[model samples]
Target: MSVYYFAGASIVAALCIMIVFKIHVDKLKHSPEQMGAILTKFFIGVAFCEVVPILLLVAGFATMQTGLEFNNLLLPLVCIFFSMIIAAVFIFLQTKVDVTQEMRGKVYTFAMIGLSLAISIPFFSLVGLLIQMQ
Candidate 1:
């Protein structure tokens, strides 16, 4: 229960943090080219962002700190994989949309929301790992 509780709470916290960051990005009013550029750079950024969380996961595993059965780790691991896939798809598609093809307000907004949520899911495994380590 502690593991699940930590995972769920961390997921919620991460999403909230992402939402805050998205709000700031939304205020920038970037042009379509700018948005596409950001999306391209963002792929690189996500990869870097994942490094620390992954190292934390490795540390936890090495220390045998996870309180759950081995199978229990599978769900969160799969979640992290799927979320990265989703983020990649969104970034790829968004970058492909030219200015003529782009929708102004809601489409970009929705995409950012989705991307942030996808990014946030990895925190589930992260929190689950960190809580056990402590």
Candidate 2:
């Protein structure tokens, strides 16, 4: 149960951080090229972002001898892979659309929301489950 608490807390924290960052990007009204730049920054941030929560998750599993193997991590990896595919399609579409920069910015925002939700699900679920067991 305690592990779940920490896991859920990590989820909420991650979401809050993403939302705040999204809002900041919304203010920028970035063009497609600029959107690419923002995404690059996001990739960098995500690496740093996963560190603590991941460590805690592994620690919880270790304590329980949960036998959660690398295979268990596949769900989230798949989610992210799919999300990236979708985003790539949207970006390609952006090149085709003669839309304003502002519209492209909005599209990028929505696309990222989808991407973030995809990336977060499994990690949060692992945490939630640990919390539930306790």
Candidate 3:
């Protein structure tokens, strides 16, 4: 029921993303041609950072049960632990993306991986939440 965990997750994610953006902006400052690609990646990174928190918040708000389901905290705790770790993973992927031929494939691969994770992790969290409430 604590909002602090969700808020902290968002803050940590935003801070990590801001660092990535700063790095990308400085690196591309000399070549404005590369800015478009970086901006695209930046937006993707932003989405990466936001997905789990929103999903978990929705789950928590919608899925709480009427009884003492306290023993099931472990499931959500694990889900939340891994959810927080995704921020660092996003930073890694964002920093790796570049506007180069060799790096193009890598970017797409990382993006797909990120997208897959963004989908799966929240889904698992929802399942965990539901299990806990039952």
User: Per-residue alpha-carbon lDDT of model 2 for 17-112, expressed as tens digits?
Assistant: 455455435533444446666666655655555566566566555554344454544554344344445434543454344556557655656456
Candidate 3: tens digits of C-alpha lDDT, residues 1-134 = 53333333444444545455555544554455575687677667667766655665565556445443656455445545565466446645564545566455544554454445444434444454555453
Every model: Cα RMSD to truth: 8.3, 8.6, 10.4
Return the TM-score for each candidate structure. Answer: 0.40, 0.48, 0.39
User: In model 1, what lDDT does residue 6 have?
Assistant: 36
Which of the two candidates, 1 or 3, achieves a greater TM-score against the reference?
1
Best by TM-score: 2
lDDT of 1 by residue, 1-134 (tens): 34443344334434443443344344333544365555555455445555554555454445545456657665655545555664547443653454233445544564665466555645555555545542
Q: Model 3 clash tally?
A: 0
Candidate 2 clashing pairs?
Answer: 1-134, 4-131
Ranking by TM-score: 2, 1, 3
Cα lDDT listed for each candidate: 0.49, 0.49, 0.51
**Poorly placed runs, candidate 2 (over 4 Å):** 5-9, 12-16, 27-32, 65-110, 113-124, 127-134
